[model samples]
Target: MDAHSAPLPAAAMPANGFGRFAGHLDRALGGLVETVAALLVVVEIVILGAGVMARYVFHAPLVWSDELASILFLWLSMLGAVVALRRGEHMRMTGLVSRVSPQTRALLEAVAITASIAFL
Candidate 1:
């Protein structure tokens, strides 16, 4: 068969052992991150809305709402970052990287990944 039409070898398929378990774990973690991030955003919105209503309608501002909302927002942002990283959607210099050769691009990507891990 032509190279372009050839079927992939058995080895090219997904793993059937520990690799499969790892894939499941990765998917579970990703789902958890997305759920937590979405929940935090909802909480932040509700808290802020409550605070606004308390101040204007009830004439009683929620003293703790701002602090709680800020904390939730921080958590939401961190979780969102995790989700973005997992989805390969985190911010990067893609415009510059796209101009480089494949080898250089790979090296740059490795360096970026290492730096990200170190920063984390």
Candidate 2:
């Protein structure tokens, strides 16, 4: 292949050095977030179930159970959202995006992201 057609060397590629480091950091954080989210779901289930059992079956309601659940639910939800964002699973108007040309689609995505950030 001619020089122009040849693939760039690893050292010369854009995705090396800091880009590669950032990619690895992103994957590591994503995996950690996913694992934490999954664990939170399980813990929440267990806490709620035990709380119910303690209240109904044993005739002694756990006074702090609801408060604990509320706090955990908030954390779990945030972690779940983080996982979704990292995995690109957040809500999107895919039908609208899919119908557009590539250039338009890119522009639409950029606009969507900017709007989301600004709204935040």
Candidate 3:
């Protein structure tokens, strides 16, 4: 059978205690990241709106709003990335990997993860 049609190996299943705990942790962290990203987006919108109102309607600019909005946007983007990664929704070029053997795929994934950790 091809990789796509093959059943997942037993080791790939999250049936053990540590695997369950890790899954729960990932979900919790993903939820937190989503919540924080949403809040940041709201705050950014409010700050931008207030800044615009103050500048055009009141003829006085809110000097700090722009900087605050930028910071909020940065955090929002980072948190969104975390959420995407947790959900396995992040962009990837998987065409070549999909055609490889399972062992090779696993090795490549391990190396990629290690490189990511080292880079971080």
- Top lDDT prediction, candidate number: 1
**Of the pair 1 and 2, which is ahead by lDDT?**
1
Question: What residue runs in model 1 are displaced by over 4 Å at the alpha carbon?
Answer: 1-14
- C-alpha TM-score for every candidate: 0.86, 0.78, 0.71
Q: Please list the C-alpha lDDT of all candidates, in the order they appear.
A: 0.82, 0.78, 0.79
What are the per-residue Cα lDDT tens digits for candidate 2 across 60-101?
Answer: 988988899899999987888777666566677877877878
- What stretches of model 2 exceed 4 Å from their correct place? 1-13
Q: Write the per-residue lDDT of candidate 3 for residues 1-120, one digit (tens) a residue.
A: 334335457688689899889878877877887988888888899999999999999999999999998888888878887776565565555887788888888887777678767976
Question: Which model, 1 or 3, shows the larger TM-score?
Answer: 1
Q: Put down candidate 1 lDDT per residue, 10-61, tens digits, no spaces.
A: 5875888887787789889889889888888888999999999999999999
Tell me the lDDT of model 1 at 59. Answer: 100
Task: Name the candidate that leads on TM-score.
Answer: 1
- What's model 1's lDDT at 2? 26
**RMSD, every candidate, angstroms:** 5.9, 7.0, 4.3
Output the worst ten-in-a-row residue range by lDDT, candidate 1.
1-10
Error of 2 at 29 (Å): 0.9
